[model samples]
Target: MKRFAIGDIHGGLKALKQVLERAKVTTQDQLIFLGDYVDGWSDSAAVISFLIELSKTHNCIFIRGNHDDLVHHWLKTDEQNENWLKHGGQSSKDAYAKLTLSEVEEHKKFFSNLENYYIDPENNLFVHAGFANMHGPQNEYEPYMVYWDRTLWETALALDENLKPEDLLYPKRFKLFHEIFIGHTPVTRINQTKPVNAANIWNVDTGAAFKGPLTMLNIDTKEIIQSEPVHQLYPNESGRN
Candidate 1:
């Protein structure tokens, strides 16, 4: 069975479908989604529904993202924050506006049950975002470090190109995993629109929340499948603006 890691989708259901189709995902494969499944565009609810259905037939692992947390908090506590609304949360709210009570409950369950991080038997780590501290994973790091930490990716990016892996002072967290896969921080932030490898960490968020395409990486073979430019798929959008 092959393992595939998908980056942040950000309500681009069309992009998500295209990537999955291009990858030719099968029941025998393990699909790991790095989260941010909602927000940005107008189909957040549709994205969640598709994921829920996909989970029924595939070995799917859903990691919690900051946006997912924001939606979950709003659903459960009826709380709203201006910052969250400004940062694509309004789109999510609008998406869910028409759902039935049962559908809303199902969506809530899906979000609440999402994994903060996942470590496979191969010692590959999958998280929506990186961890803050260099120490190992902790239960107390949720809703923050699990979905917002940039230190892990930053450290990998900061490594000297000339230094071999063995010659560097890699953090304990990095040492714990054979490889790490993350989203949240889009690769486009560095002017790239493809999956980036820094040390053993792979940042697959190709900015589908903004203007790049959705990216899917084969964890075992390093093969990549991507959709068309997200903006092209949603020309009328003001995604995450």
Candidate 2:
């Protein structure tokens, strides 16, 4: 069975559906989603509903995202974070407003149950963002770093490419996993609209929340499937712009 690392969907259910169909995903395939499944487009609640149902029939691993955490808090306490509201939270609120109390509770459970990070049998690490500890995510003193840190990606990107794993200058974190897959930071920041590899860390977030398309990468083969730019799919709305 194939294992795929999917990028941040950011409420782009249309884009999500497009990539999955383009990839021709089968029930046997393992789908490791890197999170940020809500808070950008008009289908935040719908996306969660779809994912909840999809997990029942497919091999799916859902990693937690900072946005997911914020939404869950709002659902549980009715408190809205101003920063979150400024950044795509308003859209999420708008979408979730349509759900019944029971449906909302179901979504809260889904959000609460998301994994902070996932380590596969093959030693591949899947996280929504990055971790800070040198010993790896499992040893992080700050658990939230696994889903909110950008230093891991920054460190990976800043490392000298010529340095081999066996070299003394190599990072201990990189040696802890066969490969690391992350989302959080969109590759669009670097002007690339695709999954990017820095050392052994693969950034799968292609900025579907903004102008880029949603992406899915085949972990073993390094093949990719992407949807159209999300804004095109939702022309009437600005997606976290």
TM-score of each: 0.96, 0.98
How does model 1 score by TM-score?
0.96
Measured with C-alpha atoms, the lDDT of residue 64 in candidate 1 is 94
Candidate 2 root-mean-square deviation in Å: 0.8
List, residue by residue over 80-150, the lDDT tens digit for candidate 1: 99999999999999999989999999999999899999999988889989887656556444547889888
Which prediction has the highest lDDT against the true structure? 2
Candidate 2 local lDDT, 1-241, one digit each (tens):
9889999999999999999999999999999999899999999999999999999999999999999999999999999889999999999999988999999999999998999999988899999998888888889898888989998899988999889999998988889999999999999999999999999999999999999999999999999999999999999999899
Name the regions of candidate 1 deviating beyond 4 angstroms: 139-143
